[model samples]
Target: MKYFTVALLAARGAASPPPPLPAAVALNSRKCRRSWWCRRRALGGAAGGGRMALLYRATRLKDRADTHVFTFVVTRSATREPDRDVTSKDFCCSHQRWAVAFSRTDASLGVYLVWRGACEGMRVYVDFTFTLLSRDHFTANEGFSGKQVRFSAGCAAQGRGRCITLAELTAKFADARGEFQLELTMSKVRTLYSCELRAPRLDTPPIAFAGFDWSVSASGGNKEPLTLRLVRLSGEGQRCRVRYALALGEGERRLHSGPLECVCDPEGRTPPWNPRPPSRILHKGVRLTVELVWARALAELAVSAAGRAATCYDRDKQAWALRCDTHSETVRLHMLYRDVHNVPRNHLRYVSWSAWLVRASPAPGEADADELPGAPFEHYYAQESADEGLMMETALRVEDISRAGCAFLHAGGELRVRLEWGDTYLLFQATYHVYDDLCRLHAHQMRREITALQAENYSLERQLFSYQKSLAYAQAQAGEPVGAEGTGRRSPAERSLSTDTEYA
Candidate 1:
C-alpha cells in the first residue's frame, strides 16, 4: 500500500498542469466583466494610432521539462497615423517601428510563431497587415508567413522563419501597437533568461537609387505610371524602411504609405500607384523628383552580405557594370562610338536602341542589327544576371525622319559618324571622307571661276589699247587736214596747186 502511494505521487508530478495566466491578464479578467473588449483596447489600431502599450512578453510553458522559457523582444518600432504626419509621434508607423522577436532555447521543434509589423521602403497610404505563428504547418494561415521582422534572435540559417496570420491569433495576444507585458511566475526548476531589446542602428543606412520613374515621355516629359521596387542586393538579414518625397522648389511634398520591409530577399516592392502624377511633377520649373531614404541598420546588413571586395559599380575593358548582388549574372552593354555621350546623357531625337544577348562576343566589325535578338523591347532590363553570362550589344538606329546624322559608340574602340541622306537612303560612313570630298569640290569650282575671270580681263585690256590707238590716229589726221588735196575746200586745193607751182 505504501509503494502504491509513492507511485501515485510520482504520476501526479509527471502530469503537466495548465500554465497559469499572466498577472496583468489575471487583473484585467477580474477588473473587467468584458475581457474581450478590455483586450481589444490594449491592442490599439489606426484610430488609436496603433500605439503599442508593451514591447516584450514572456510566459512559462506547460511542458516545462521538454521546452525552455520563451522570450519576446521588440527589435524595431512603427505606428500608423493614416492622414497625419508620420513624425507627429502620435504614430511612428506600425510598419517601420514595430517588430517583435521570439526567442527560445530549442527553436528547432514545433510551435512556430508568426509576428508582423510595419516594413520600410513602402508608402504608408497602402494597406498592409501581419500575423503570428502556430504549431500547425499544413493548414493555411497556420504556418510561416513571408512577413518577417529583423533584429530577432533565431536560427537564421533556416532561411525563412515560420509565421501565422493575425486572424488566427486571439485578440488578447496580437496587436499592432508597440506594447508588451510579460508575467513571471517563480519556479525553482526553471532558470531565468533575460530578453535583450536592441535599438536599430540609424547612422549609416542602405543605399537606394534616387528613385527612377518608368516611361518618362521624351516629348512632353510626362510619366506613364509609378511603380516603386527595390532589391536587397548585398544586405542579407538587413532591415530597411524606404520613404519617398517629391521635391517642390520651395519645400518638399511627401506621400506617406506603408513602409516597405526588406528581408534580404530579391523581391521587395512598394505598392503600385498610378494616380495622375501631381501637375507640378512635370512642370519644368518644379524640378520634382522622387527621393528614397532608409535606415542605417539595413545598410550594415547589406555591407556584411556583400563581403569586403564586392562593389556596387565597376568598370573593365569589356563593359561598365552596375552591381546589385541580388541579380543572378553579370552582363556587358557595349557602346559603339568613343565620342558618344555617356549614359544619363540626353539621347538624340528619334534615336532608337536595340539590344541583344549573345552567347559569344561579336568579332570586331561583325555587328549586324538583323541578326540581333528578336523583340529588343523585351531586353530592356534594370538589372542583369551575375555570371560571366552574356554580352549585350545595342543596335542603334534613327528613324521617323528623311535624313539623319548621328554618332554612337560601337563594339570596336573608335569614333564613328553615320549619315543617312536623300530619299534613296545613301549612307555616308566616315565624316573625314565626306568633308574631304566637299573641300575638293569647292576648290574645283573656285579654280574654274578664277580661270574665266582672268580670260575676260585680258580681252578688256586689248580692246582698251585699240580704242586709244584709233583716237591718236584720228587726232593726227585732223592736224594734217588743212593741206590735204581731198579736203572739202576746193579753193584750198587750187591754192595748194598754185602754191606748188610757185614753189617749183
Candidate 2:
C-alpha cells in the first residue's frame, strides 16, 4: 500500500509542472535538501508551488519576537538591610535565562538585570524599564529605566544605582503583607555576534568597540611560537581587560580560555598572547576561533603629593634658584622589548607641561585663573636606544627663575605643574609658604639700608645750612651795600634751593 501511495504521488507531481525556483534557492538546492525547514517546504511545494515555499521561509526568518518581559517578587525586608542583595528565580526569555537583583546599601536601592547564560562572543543590547507593582498589582511605580545597556561576557549585569530610596520603597512599593512584584520589560533588544579566528597572520578586519577600532595581529611565524596581539588603530589612551576563549580550530575543539589584560593608547597595540614552548608552530592556514567575551576600561594611576618650596642663592650657577621639593611619588615606566616595539622611538611625550601660579579659588566674575597661560619652562625629550636601560624617569624642571619667581614668593598662591607623559598625567602642586627665616633676613637688610639713607640726608642738610650762613656773613663784611656789587646774582642758599627744585 505504501509503494502504491508513493507511485500515485509521483504520478501527480509529474502531471503538473513545478513552479520556477528563485536563483538563491536553485543555487543552494543541496543545502535546502539538508535543512529541515527546506524539506518541509519541498513537501509543501509539491502540492503548492516553489515560490510560496521561498516566501514562507523568508517571512519566518523576519518574524522572530524581539521583546520580552519578566516578572518576579521580593520582600520588603530585603530593602531595609544594608549591603543586602535579593535575587529572583531564573526566568527564560529569548532562549536566555534572566534574573533581577535588588541590592541595598544604606538607604539606596539598586536594580540590576543579570543574564545567566554563556557570554562567549555574545552581546545583547537592550532598552529596559523596571516597575514596582503594589500588592494589588494594579498600580505601577516605575523604578528606573535604561537605554542601550549592553550585556556581554565581560559585563553580565547592567542597571542603575540608587534607583529608589529605602524610604520611598517602603512607603510606595510594599503591600500590607510586605511583598511586592517587580517587572522588567526589555524592549528594542538587539543581539551582536562575534566569532574569533586565529591564523598565522590575521585576515579579519578591525572591529569597532568603545569608540575605537580594534584588530588582531600575529607575530613570530615559522619555528617560533605565535604571539597574538590586540592593536588599537585609533583613539586616545585606554586600558581594558579582555576575556577571550582560545580554541584549536573552527570546530568546537577547545584548547585554552582565559582573560587577557591590555593597555592601548592612540595608535598603540598590546601584546597579550605569548604562547609558551618556543617550538609550537602555527601553520599558515591553520585557524583557531577566539571569542572576545568581555572588555572593561581600567582607570589610570593617579598620585598626588604636597611640595615644599625654598629659595637659595646658587654659588655654582651664580644665580638665585627657586626650588620646590614636591615630595612626589616616583612613577616609573618599564619598557620591555615587546612594548618598546609598539611605541614610537622618537616622539614628544608631553602634551602640556607648564607651571601655573594661581590662587586656590578665583573670585567671582574673574576670568578663571587656572585657564590662563602658564610660564612654559624648558623641556627636552629623550630617545631610547636598544642598549639603553629599561627603566625611565620623568623629572621636569622650572628653570631660569627671574621676576616671576620673585613675585611668586611675595604673593602666595598655588603653583601647579601639570606634566603629561603619553597617555598618563601627573599633577604636581606646591602651595606657597613664605620661608619665615628668609623673609626675616631680607627685612633686616632693608631696615639697615633705610637707616643709613636717613642719616646721610640729615648730615647733608646740616652742611648746606652752615655753608649758607658763612656765605651770608662774608658777603655782609665785604659789602658796600648788600645788593650793590652784583644786582642779578643770587645768594648761596637761593642757588642751592633752585638747584634742588630743578632736580626734583
Candidate 3:
C-alpha cells in the first residue's frame, strides 16, 4: 500500500516524497483486506501519506480561471537580488493593458497587478485573484484575492505586498527551470463613471452617466475653504455612492481626506464637502475628480419645489417683504441680508453671502414637526458686483410649512450667515425671538444696549485696577506713599474720579 501511495504521488507530480505507513494501518492489513470500508480507509491513509496532493490540486483548480490569466515568472538570478521586481509582459483585458508584477524585498515575495493603460482620469473597478502556482501547475501554494478593488491614476496597481516568503517560494513553487511562477486571474473588469472639472463654474452642465444626468457645483471663493457638491439633474428615485478627490490651487496639494466617500440619496444630491484643516485655501482654478462607484434604484421620493424667492426687510413698510412671485406654494421661508457698506453714487462692491435656516423645536402641542414635509436648504449668493446700498437678499423654501407642527412662529430658530469678500470671512448668527408689538421690539433693543454697556463698564473697571497697581508699584519703588499720607486712602479728587469712572 505504501508503494502504491508513492506511485500515485509520482503520477500526481507532487514534489515531496511519500511518507511511511502508520503502525495501525500496517498491523491491520488482514482486516483492511476483509472489509470494503477498511480497504477504503487504507487507501485514504495512503493518500494522506503522499500529503493529499490530489485534494490540494482539486481545491486550487476550483479557484483557477481560464480567461484573463496573466503569468509572471521570477528568474533565479532575479530572486537572488533583494529589491528586484520582475514584471510580466502586457496583456489586454477589458480593452486595457494589464500585467502581473513580482517583486522580492529582502526575503519576502510581493505580487501585484499593474495597470498600463492611458489614465485619462478614470477609475477602474476590478475583481482579481493571484495564485502562486506550483512547479507542476496543478496546485497553488499561496493565493490572494481582491474584490471590487479600485484602480486609478493615483493608484495604478493593486495586490498583496507579502503574498509569500522568498524562502518558501524557492523551496516549494519554483519550476524545474529554477523560476518562481505566479498566476493572476482577473474578472469583472469595468470602468466607473468618472468626471473631472478644472476651474469649475458655479453650476456645471449636467453630464450623463448610467441613464442619469449629474452635475457638480462649487461654492466658497478663492480665499475660503472650497466646498464641492454633486447634484443629480435628471434622474429620480436613484441612489449612488461616489468618491471625490480634490486638488487645490496650481500646486495640486491633495486633500488629506483622500478619496472622500459620499452616498447620494434619491434626491440626487450629496452633502457638501468642505475639506478640513481650514488653512488649506482653495484657489480659483482648482481641480476636482468624482467617480460613481456604485449605484442602485430607490423607492420614489416625495417631490418638492426647487424655486427660491428673494426677500428683504422693507424700510418703508417696517416689515419683511418678498421681492419675487409669492404665488409659488414652495415659498415657505425667507432670508434677509443687511449690507454693512454704504455705496457712493456709482460704485459697486462684490460681496458673497451664504445662509442656512435651522429649524428649532416644534410649537406647543406639536410632536411631528420634524416629520413635516420640508427639506433643509441653504441660500448662497455668488460674488458679483452689486450696489452696496441695496440689501443683499436670497431665499429658500420648505414644503408644507402650514401643516400642523411646522409653524415657524416659535422660538429657538437660528439663522446662520456667512459673508466673504476678498480674503475676509465673517460669520454672524442670530437666535429667533418673538415680539408681539413694536414696544417689545424697542425694549429688546434697549436691553441689548444695556448689556453691551455693562460689558464695557466691566472692562473699564479692570483697566482702572491694573493702572492703580502699576502706579502704586512705581510710588513704592520711589519710596513715596502709595496713598495719601501712606494711609492707603485716596484724596477727595481721586475719590471723585473713582466715582465718575464707576458710573461711566
Candidate 4:
C-alpha cells in the first residue's frame, strides 16, 4: 500500500518540472542577476568572481629591496597551492610562466616589467604600448634595434591553444581607441608581449631543442651573444642537410633545419650525408615532436604516441617523436617532452632586488616568478619564466613556436656560444645564470647542435614510419602478414625495440 502511494506522488512531480529557461530573458537584467553569477562562476566568471587558480597565487612577500612591478594572472594549472615555497625543487612543466593579473584597484592593464639582476647592471627601457579593445583581444607592436616583433590575442571561448601571434595579436581590430571596460579581475587575462632587440640573450636562437637530450642543449642567461654555433659540422666539407629544434619550457617547440652545404667541399663537391642529428633533440619527455623534413617539396612532421604515455617511443616500429616541413631541404625537430617542473613556489627567497643585477623590484601587473626579480634558489639564477623574462617577452613577437619551454635568460652565468664552419671559428659572448632546475643553459651556438639533431631525428623517424606503413599496406593487399608472431615483418631495428608502440 505504501509503495503504491509513493509511485502516485512521483508521477505527479514529473508532471511539473522547473519552468522552461525564461524563453527570451534579457541579459544583464536584475530579474535574473542572482542566477547569473551562479551559472558562470566557475569557468572564467566575471570580476571579483574571477579565479586565480591555486597554482597561480600572487608573490606575497612584500617588495622592499626594489619597487618591482607586480601583476596578478593565473595560468591554468592542476595544482592549487602554488605560492608555497618550492626551494631547490624543479619548476612545473605543465605551465612554465605565470598568468598575470591586475587588481580591481589597478588603473592600468600591462606588465609591471620589473628588472632584477645582481648589483643592478643592465639598463631596461620598455616603450611598447598595447590596447585592449575588448576581452580576449589586444593589439600592439614594438621595434628593437631594427627587428620588428608582433602581438596578438584570441578568445578562449573558441577553444584552448587557438593563439594569435604578434602580428595577429594586434591586427584583429583597428578601432580599439583606449581600454575596454573590464571587471578588474575577470577580463584581465594572463597576458604576455614580445619586442625585438639587439641582445642575443634577450632573444632565442633561430633554432633550438628542449627538454632532456643525451646531448644537452645550451642555455642562454641574461643577454646572449649576437652569433650562435652548429657544434661540430665535420661533414667532411660535404654539402650535408640536417635539422635542429627550439623549446620554451611549456609553450610550443619549433624544429628548423636547412642544408649546411659546404659550397667548397674539401672531400668532394657532393657528400653522402651528414651524420644524422640525434632523435633526442626531437623530444622533451612528451609525445609531440616538431619535425622539419625536406622531401621533394618541404619538411614534414607529426606528434607521436602509442601504448602508455604520449611520448613513449618504440624502436621496433622505428617510431619517434617528430615531423617534417615539405618546402625545406633540411629537417629539424623538437619532441614535446615530459615537462619536469617550474612553478610559483620556486620563487620565495627574493626579498629585494639588488641595484639591478641581483633582484628585481616587484612590478605591478607582473605575475610569473621568472619575470619578477628573484634569485634562482641560492646557487643558480632562474630568470625568464613562461609569463615573464625580458627575452621571453621578445620571443613572443617572433611567434617562435619552438623553445617556448626551454629558452630563457639567466642572470648569474656567462652566456656564450662557439661556432665552427670548417675551422672558420667564431665565438659569441652571452650573459649567463643558473636555473632553479640545476640544468646548465648554454649561451652560444651550442644551441644549434641539439636543435639540429632533434630535427634530423624527427625526419628519420618519419621516413621509417612512411616506409613501414607503405610496406605493410602493400603486403596486406598481397595477402601477406605484418610483424612476427605470424605477422611476418622485416627491419632489425623494429624487432629490437621492446615496447609495443605504434607509429601512427
Give me the runs in candidate 2 sitting further than 4 Å from their true place.
Answer: 1-65, 134-140, 200-504
lDDT of 3 by residue, 309-355 (tens): 33332211111222222355444323333333232222222222222
Which residue pairs clash in candidate 3? none
lDDT minimum window of 10 residues, candidate 1: 418-427
Better of 2 and 4 by TM-score: 2
TM-score per model over all chains? 0.19, 0.28, 0.28, 0.17
Candidate 2 lDDT at 103 equals 47
lDDT of 1 by residue, 155-256 (tens): 111112222222333233323432212211212221111111112211122332312111111112234333323333443333333443322223345333
Error of 2 at 34 (Å): 44
Better of 3 and 4 by TM-score: 3
Tell me the lDDT of model 3 at 292.
46
How accurate locally, in lDDT, is each candidate? 0.26, 0.43, 0.45, 0.23
Off by over 4 Å in 4: 1-106, 112-209, 212-504
Tens digit per residue, CA lDDT, model 2, 1-504: 232343345445442332222223211133432242233234452233111000000001113434555444455535543322245544444434566654445666666676666345657767777776543223234666778777776555566555666777777766554545566777665544455444444534665543345566666657667666677665555444444444434454434435555445445666556644332444445454454543444332212222332222110111111224333343222222222222333222211122223333455875323322332222222333432323333332223222354222223423432221211111111112221223344456667767877777656755886876776678889873555247887665566556454321
Alpha-carbon shift of residue 489 in model 2 (angstroms): 99
* Global Cα RMSD, each model: 38.4, 35.1, 29.4, 28.3
